[model samples]
Target: MSTESHNAENTGSNDSVVETSNLAGSGDFLIVCEHASNYIPPAYKNLGLDETVLKSHVAWDPGALAVAQALSKALDAPLVEQKLSRLIYDCNRPPEAENAMPAQSEIFTIPGNCNLSQADRDVRTKTVYFPFREALATCLDHLQARGKSPVVITVHSFTPVYKGVKRDVEIGFLHDQDDIFAKELIKTFAAETDKFVLRLNEPYGPADGVTHTLTEHALPRNLRNVMLEIRNDLISDQESQQDMATILAQAILQAEKTLGKHKNHTAPTTKPIKTGN
Candidate 1:
């Protein structure tokens, strides 16, 4: 289904499920923020939760959109973002995954997601998940048609403390089976920044199912890709978000230069399934 038709059907006075910015940008980087907003449509009734929970990090990545927007502007790249709350349906996850409509996130329970019927799950997938994926796919297709091999960069945020433990790592570069690009970018960040702890998959890793978007969109196409997880506390304000985005943008540019030198890098042979659902 087309994005306009899906938005008309599902979003009642709310923003579109998927929003694209700088679509005509000529840069070689394509930014994606799967949990950009925490807005739930009036139809869901806040997913049967209190108003306070809807605004918390559990509902969405607190500063991911700000960093993504900054990076899009800095790099002159197109950005595809999800506008609905993850509580409705996490755009980053496969539609059939249990966490797609999470019954609980972090320590809070999602009352609306519990005991959902199959029909309800299907509706969520059809309305929110598919449209978001289709929009991103369309963006990639557009760039590819223009002879652009855009690097996919998915931005995310992590809580300072999870499950009662404090996380010392400030930034995490996550990857799936393909780690060449991510490793290069990590080396660049390590050499350039000494202000915060940088690590490979500290807070979340491939096992956490966080790489679904990268694997689905970038892996099959052999696009240089990585998922960046910044500490929410570090980017709690506009100034910090801009600062972090600058650092990340520089690292990405450096990595691109380095990768450009290696002309024979081969992509994986396993093809992704046609449907991310």
Candidate 2:
């Protein structure tokens, strides 16, 4: 059964901004999808965006949640997701980051985000970001208390093209400070005969402040972690999302074997890093 935490209210309907699922999962993974929803509460006035724009990548990662749920089912892993549009407050970003509540995204300007006083931004943070953060922290603490050093796997999708430039990378494995898991995943994908167009960090990287969740929740605790960025077009449909989820779940399972519950958390000897976006 799934459990939800609600905050935003619209037209007398209870809307949840954070959700947790499969908490009693028997697997050793925690699946996170920060950009899971595009549902904007009436509070921001759609962040002053058009309907089409609100449904675009800037609002949320289209198929990321589908894939994340698939992965959770495939691996019997626990999952957590945010249900509000990232334009409100990107859960993946700390409140201090500029893009946490972006004033502009791509060529489109965010009128609601512009000229915001600290109090205005803080309201969004309190409403959306903090609850999600606490939920994740509680999940991790519970798992650790149960003697499970769960692997942190965050799923996301990047637009195939950005600013009119077509991206060549089909999958990107990103890591923050911890590189062993990402390197192993790269190796696994590289060995695949199908040969996916992959990279270490393609559309984004730690330098871009995309690793805030990883650093905030995983790094300090010394957990194996990797952020998977799939090209949105690849997983645009349910079948494709499941296919990609199957592929990722297998890779993660294999990578876990290589690490073998490394209580010491030592990096396994692996090939040289060559694959990149």
Candidate 3:
């Protein structure tokens, strides 16, 4: 079920948490945008930060949702996204992680998230984290019922500079220990496009704990998966987002074809692996 409309409604200052589009698409690919929106649901009062911070990359991946939506259209794939800001509760992180409700992200401190009581943490987990997980699980279950195994592609964006240091990679394909799917994508992108710098785990890696969603949801099931991180500056607008999506969509399609040819020869690991950025 696509919760595009109802999932955008947050009653009584509560967050909607999860939003999905193209939920019934038949393609054997699933697109996920964990930091899609920067919405703070009014209850947190912008997490006690200014409007600029709310719009910054610290709150959300600036253009990840647009790229994911474009990919959903391009590939006829289902897209599931978190509707609230990561400051509320990072959907990509496990609840036990310290940054799950980060007191500080990058250099800015999240005043609202500081010194949280156990009850406050639990509420955020129950309201935001659990719902997001359930939504993705439900979607995956539906696809499995149809005998369709999906290649999960997570879309994310990173700032061009981190703590005043510039990052050289324009695009990053992040993966955990199971790098088969990510490696295939990297090879395809390297061969097909030279417009931007591409690398494997550049700005962030599994050590950054950014691959929690993939590790928790896809790895155990042995689902082919990859996390694509575009430099935020590269996809700051509609045109750029569309361009990146087209480039990524082509690469993913080509990689899927390659995976198909080697399906019988290789299989993805089913064991839960250590997570990453």
The whole-model lDDT of each prediction reads 0.86, 0.85, 0.85
> By TM-score, how accurate is candidate 2?
0.93
lDDT of 3: 0.85
Best prediction by lDDT: 1
User: After best superposition, candidate 2 residue 224: deviation in angstroms?
Assistant: 0.4
Clashing pairs in 1: none
The lDDT ranking, best first, is 1, 2, 3
Q: For candidate 3, lDDT tens digit of each residue in 35-102?
A: 99998877577879999999999999999999999999999999999988999989899888989999
Report lDDT (Cα) of residue 179, candidate 2.
Answer: 90
Give each model a TM-score.
0.93, 0.93, 0.92
**Model 1, range 159-210, lDDT digits (tens) per residue?**
9998788989899988777778888999998778889998887678877788
